[model samples]
Structure formats: structure tokens, C-alpha cells
Target: MTAVFAAPAGPTASRRDTSPSAVPRAREFRHTTDRDEAIDVITEVYVPHNLVLPTCAVDMTLAWTPLRHLVLGYLSYGAESYLIAPKLETFYHVNLTIRGRTGSQRGAEEVETGNDVGLVFLPSEPATVHWSEDCMQLAMKIDKDGLEAELARLLNRQVTVPLRFDLALELKKPKVSSFVRALQHLRSELDEPDGIVASPLGVAQLEDTVITSLLLGQPSNYYDELHSSAGSALPRTIAPVVDLMESEPDNPRSLGAYASVAGLSVRALQDTFRRTLEVTPMEYLRGVQFDRVRADLLASDPETTTVTQVMHRWGFTHAGRFSTNYRKRFKELPSETLRCH
Candidate 1:
């Protein structure tokens, strides 16, 4: 079975989506018989992988559509086959077998996907997939930073680690069912020439919808953190201290300095900040500092300035944590912002 879109033909290039939407026009094709060509084509759309020759003849078809940082595609290897792929490294992959069946192996873990089950492959793991002769899968490729940015937005804090999702998505669960429907809806809309997908804002919002659904519905390392509520709003008494921090975000101050200004004991100030803001005083301070860093990155020219110079000027001396917090706060790297400036 084939899933060809009623659109222009191309190898990897398709007509640009008419409305300047995040979704580009669909790229649909049945590729070369040479295994190497098949590999090259898939690699162009996705990442590199080793395609093990099948016992029978090879017939591969891929109908792909890219929406900004995510790609939604239907893939079929016209024969029973196996593919060994290295660690996806910088992104995530999800596969829903709509027809026949598929099996995935990662480390000692092995799982089969079908109508009632789906698979999510995280970035850190190497994987192998076994596709049945008649298998057809709707595979999703999501950029890691973009997905993590959404996660950071939801958590109201930076993502400290790569998201970890259990390999199998239990389709029977209500949340999972809803998420699958979201994917199916987007897939259907892709075929509509003037659907919501044709609207620039509509496509971006839909992309956010799918990303947020996956982050929330499909459980991950941050699942519990997402569900937990934050502390109550800040009290008026602490307004002046917050104002001081905002006025001088680049200024590095100890907890005692903050406490002295607030006229509270160090421990009392710490407890008050946590009870009101759900963060330590220093964490809140870091958030303020990060905002300033973003402002400076946006204001400076990349050719004349460096992320390190800007970061250190704002007292963000710890390189690793600065990068993580930067991405979490703004959803892109400091360097990414610098380049755009």
C-alpha cells in the first residue's frame, strides 16, 4: 500500500507551502532499487542507518512532509527487513505501525509495535527495527532542542536532562489515545490543499499541539515535575527584593545579601522564596540573569561578540549549566540567538 499525496513530485524537494507556513509541501516518492540509494534518500530525510538486505526483493516507499522542526512521514519497506541505526543523537523518533507489524530492539529491550502499541526512540540509544513484509508505519522525526524547549516552557524551568520515554506507548490509555488522534488529525490535514496546514500560524500552533501532547501524554523523565503544581504567587513584601534583582540582573549576590535587603534570616528568606516562588533565591536570580543574557545575545553581533564573553559578563561562569539553562529559558542555544543577531 502507498500513501502518496496529491501534490508536486520531487526527490527530497517539494513545492514550498504557499502560505509561508511552517509545513513545507509534501515530498512523496518511491525510490531507487539500489539499497545504497534507498539509504541515501532516507538519510537525507532522517539520519544515517545501516539497511540490512532482506531475504526477498526490496521495494521502498516514503511519503514525507516536514513542519519546521518535525517531520511526519509514512514509510514502507516493500519486503520483510531489518535496519540497524546508531544513536539518533540530537532528536527523537516515534513509529506507529498502521498496517502489519514492526519490532524494535534497543539494548536488551525488545518490543513489537502495532495498532495497540507504538514506539518512541530517544536520542541516546542505538536501535534496530524489524519490519514485516506488509508493514507500513507513520514515523515522526522531532528535533531534540525544539522538543526540549517546549518541555522547558511547560516546566517553568530548564530541562536538566534529555527526556526519557518508555519505549512502548500503550495506545489503550486515554492520554495516549488522544495523542494518537492528534497525530492522525495532522496526517489527514496534510492531504487537504487548503487545510489549517496551509495557514502559517495554524501550522506552527498545530506543531506545538502535537509536541505538547507528546510531552504531556506520553510519560517521560519530567512527567512528574510537569504534573506537580508550583508554589503560590509572590507576596507583596518581597516585591522590592525582586525589583532589585530585576534592575541589576547581572549583579551576583549571595543569599545573605538578598536576605539582608529583605531583612530576613538566610534560612527564613530561603524558605519564603521557595514557598512563594517554588525556587531557591539563587535559582530565581539565575532566571533573571539568563533573561539578560538573552537580551545581550540578541543585541550583539556574532562576528564581534562571543557567547562566552557575554555569559561571563553576566556572571554565568559555569559553561555547561549556562548552556542548559539558556536553552531551557528561551528554547534555543545562546549561540543560536547570537547568529540571528
Candidate 2:
């Protein structure tokens, strides 16, 4: 059974329905004879596979489960075909061959993947995948934004750059192999009639699990940052302080208050902040406060909201120093910003 449930069309879309049966049921195509129809269907739901069909009759089974921000597909076809995708710019495809063999090329690197070796296709990379007639693959598609968001959460930072992944996955390693096994288990649970995935919470948890597993198992650009030992505790400890500063930038803050929020002594907090962010705790706080003040200055009516009002509102007691810092950060005078806006 191929389950391809179209997620609701919005940012907060999921497959969960009060009546579970109302959810889009899985569909399967067994021994599909029409080559053009197969190509069209696969291209629409899956990636565009400019399939090179053999002269012999095409026989294949295609089944997929499309959950929120993720899709699981199973394909077993006796017809040889090549999956030619120049760039998968939206999602990350993790192709695991359950039976038989396949080969893929991304750039100059080409290798054969079978039951042992899984293949990962990132959004930034182009791929040329060729599968043998006897190949049966369990394919997983992860939404790009969801995965990146998860990575950012785990790393305690905003991911401003594209995440490029390693193409070939050697699943012999315990962590990699465990991630594949977990994926298989989740698929089995979803396949059941009364599976937990019928609930919204279940779907969300499963999405998180898949994304977290991939982040931990796969190597990417921020891999070193995640696994780094330097100031490891600082990032976690300072996260709350950063959140507080961002959320309530105008609120009066001091090193002692931030230290309490971070559950560290003032001295320890200062040292950690300097090590992790190369800025003192007060310096970081000042930056956030300045940003808020500048936003107000830019958006406010100069007639109603003066530089003095904005500065005092954001806890800047001095006019000259505030102007100096604001100019340094925005490369423009606060007065200029207010006048222009």
C-alpha cells in the first residue's frame, strides 16, 4: 500500500483528521502497464524521473505515505529506469534500496548502492540515479525547511546558509544503521490501520524524530559546530539569556540578571559569553537593545516619537553614546532613519 496523503496547503498543515478514515489513504499501482502514465504519476508526486523504459513490458509497484513535511515511498519495478534530477531544490531524498541494486552520480562521484549502502540526495546537489530492473527501494522525502529548522534548534543558532549533505551513506556505522532501522519501524507503525500517526501529535513527533535522526546521522556543513566541545555548555546555557534579550529587549537588564537567567554566576556567565560569542554578556544585551531602539526609530513618527523617547524606551539613558552605537551598527544616524521613514 502506497500512502501519499497531501498535507493541508499552509504553513501549519498536517494529515491528522478527527475521522482518521478521512485522511488521504495510501494508493498502490501494481504491474502498471502504461509507461507514460507511470512517468507522469511519478513525476507529479515524486521527483521528475525522466525514466528510460525498456522495450519489455513495464511491471512495477509504487506505494507511498505522505505525512506532514515528510513522504515515505516504496517502489519495486522490473523495468530498468534512470532517475535524472538536475537539482532537487525543495526536499532531501533519502533512497534506501531494500532489495537488488542501484547506482547514482552526483557531480564526478559515482557509486553502486544496494541493501547495505543507502544514498542521500540533498537540495543543492544534482543526481543521476540508475536502478536495476529487480530493484526495490524505500524512499524517504524530508521537507527542506523543517529539517533546517530542526538543525537550527539543535545547534542553538539560526541557519542562514544552505545545508549540503554527503551523498553516499555508509550504514555500517551504528548510528547510521540505527537511523535506518528507526525509519523502517516508523513506516511499519504508520502502515497499520490504527497507527499512532492518525493523531496530530503522533505526526508531529514522527516528523521531529526523522529530522533529528537525519541531523545526528548525516554529515553537513554545521556538523562540526554541533559536535564541537568548545563552549559546549555555553550555547545551551546562554540560549535562554539570548531569548530573553530578544523577547524583551527594552526591559532593564544587567550581568547579574542574565547570570540568574542562565543559572550561572556573573563571572562564569561573562567568561562563557566571551568564549562562545566573543562578546561580553552586557555587550550582547546592548546589541539587542540597540536593534529594538533602531527599529522603533525607523518605524516611528519623528513628530510623535523622538530619538530620546526611543532611546529611553529601550533603556538607553545617554543620548550621545546611543547615537554613536546606533550609527556604528546601522551605518546611519538615528535622526536620518527617523526623517527618511
Candidate 3:
């Protein structure tokens, strides 16, 4: 029942792959020999399920990297298994068995997944799965609520119908392949200790990109509406707020204040921002402040000026976070900017 949320700190798994597609060990890791403990580990990431293992000796390995809107996991039961789970309720999962094979059934739909082939499990259906002795699955859990909310914001209207996706996920298709590649890129880039996603802007942008791509490219019930949505008009909706951010780089405003300027509710303003700029109003303002801070740092004499002073003038109070964002945005540390100047 040992679960390590950070990178693995124990002996290595000889079979673990170093490929970019694999969620790095630096993600959350868990391994167990006890049957109940193994079940608990699985339930920790997913909903409770009835796990009928053929043997009393259970060995399971679980690894996951949880993000703001989704969770990426790798799971393997080193024995034959059958699991019956209730309606997913909250999340939609895409399962790809990278080793051996898996059989899944929901209602009348049945799928055998292996290698590049995958099956999408909708939130509305109960599921049953059979895992082979050597099976290892790259299980991706996407936040259903967040995804639906993204779709609504993009179309700028309420979504009355269930967002059911086509069960078969053809990974070989150019669009699906590109979406998978983007997730892999996010895993690699965000796993670093001081990765670019440390900044609010980077996090918002990546999360938005993931949700938007999935909604647009995946065969969903909302396909036609998404294609016809007035997403182009969103830029105009948020332009006033952006103008305010640019005009008053040093001014820090709450979400409500900014929304008032845009003549929309706080929620609408935030949604419009993600749909248009892939970042929130606050993140955009922070980026503007960083630009101003960099300007001050470059023009001031290093002997008389300080990074802290310039940062405070731009309303950046957190030294470590500010430096990380500044470095990511400018490709160098703020001190480096001042030193070189």
C-alpha cells in the first residue's frame, strides 16, 4: 500500500520504459502486493470498483501525474484480472493498453484495446474490463466537468446535451495523434522542478490547449456547434480588459473589477479570456507587469537599482515565483537582465 506522490524513491522497475510517451517516474508512483491495498491505490485515482483478481497474490504498479484539469496514469496488474465499476460520474477516461491487451464492455459496446488502439469510456456508463497477465495501460482521466465548461465557454452558450465522444479513439489519425503528442509534450515540460508551468500564464495556456484540442478534434456530440461557435468574437469581448491591463501595467485589479470593465460577469470574463488568449485576465496582466519590470531593470543602473524594487513597483511580491516567471518569459533571470545592461 505504499504510494509515492512525487517521483519514485525506491528500487527501479526493470521493465519501465524511458520513452517520452511514458509518464516519467518523477510523477506520482505506487506499488503494492496486498490485494486490498492494490485496490485502494486504484480507487485513489479513480472511482471505487469491484476488483476480482484470479490470485490472492496481487502486484500492482500505479503512476500518475495530476494536472489542473486532468490526470494521466499508468496502471498494470501483474496477473489476470476482472474489474466492474459504476458509472464514471465525474470523469471520462481513455484507456490504451501498451503491453498485452485489454477487453472492455459497457452496455452493448465491446472493445479490445492494445498498443496504438484505445477506447474512450464515457461518464454515463458503468464499465467492466478484463486485463491480461502482462497488461499495462496508459490511462488518461480527463475532467468531464471542466471539459464541458470549456465547450460551453467556447460556444458562449449553455450545453444542454451530453458530450458523448465516439468510443473508438483512433490514435493513428492525424488529429488524435497530434492531441496525444501535445499531452506528451506537456508531461515532459511540466515535470521539470522549475518548469515553465510554474508561472500562472504557462499553466493556464497548457490546460486550455489540452481541453480545447480534445473538444474540437474528438468526435463529440457538440462538434457542429463548436465549429460554428463565435469564438472569433471572443477576442473583441476581452479586448477592453486587455487594453486596461496594458495601460495600467502596475495596477493590480481583482477579477470583479476587470469584469466590470468588460461589462460581463466574472465567470464570463474569465471564460472569454481562456477562449480568446488561453490565459486568464490576471495572468495576462501579470505578463504585462513582467514586461514593465524588465523595462525598469534594463534602464536602471545596477549599482543603484534592485530587482526587488522594480518587482515591487510592478506589484510582484513573491521573490521566487516572480523570478521564475520572469525567467520563463524573458529567457533569462531578472538579475541577468540588469547585469547585462
lDDT, candidate 3, 19-82, per-residue tens: 4344454467886767888888788787789889876555678878777767877787777888
Q: What is candidate 1's lDDT per residue for 1-341, written digit by digit as tens?
A: 22222222232212221221222335555445577778888888888998986564666767788887698877766677888899897789988876678889976789987667889998889999998876767789998867977886776444556689889988777877777768767777776858898798888888888888888788878777776664122455565677788788777678888888888899988888776656788887887788678778878988899999999988888899899978865667899989964
Kindly give the stretch of ten consecutive residues in candidate 3 with the minimal lDDT sum.
1-10
- lDDT for each residue of candidate 2 in 1-341, tens digit (9 for 90 to 100): 11122221222112112122322235443335577777776776677767676554455556677777788776655557776786777688888876567999987778898777888887767888887866667778887756876775676544546787788877776667667667756766776757887788987887788778777887777777777865244477888998987688777577898999999999999888777766787777786687677668767998887888888988988889889888766557889879974
lDDT, model 1: 0.75
* Candidate lDDT (C-alpha), each: 0.75, 0.71, 0.74
| Candidate 3 Cα lDDT to native | 0.74
TM-score of each: 0.70, 0.64, 0.61
lDDT winner between candidates 1 and 3: 1
Candidate 2 accuracy as lDDT: 0.71
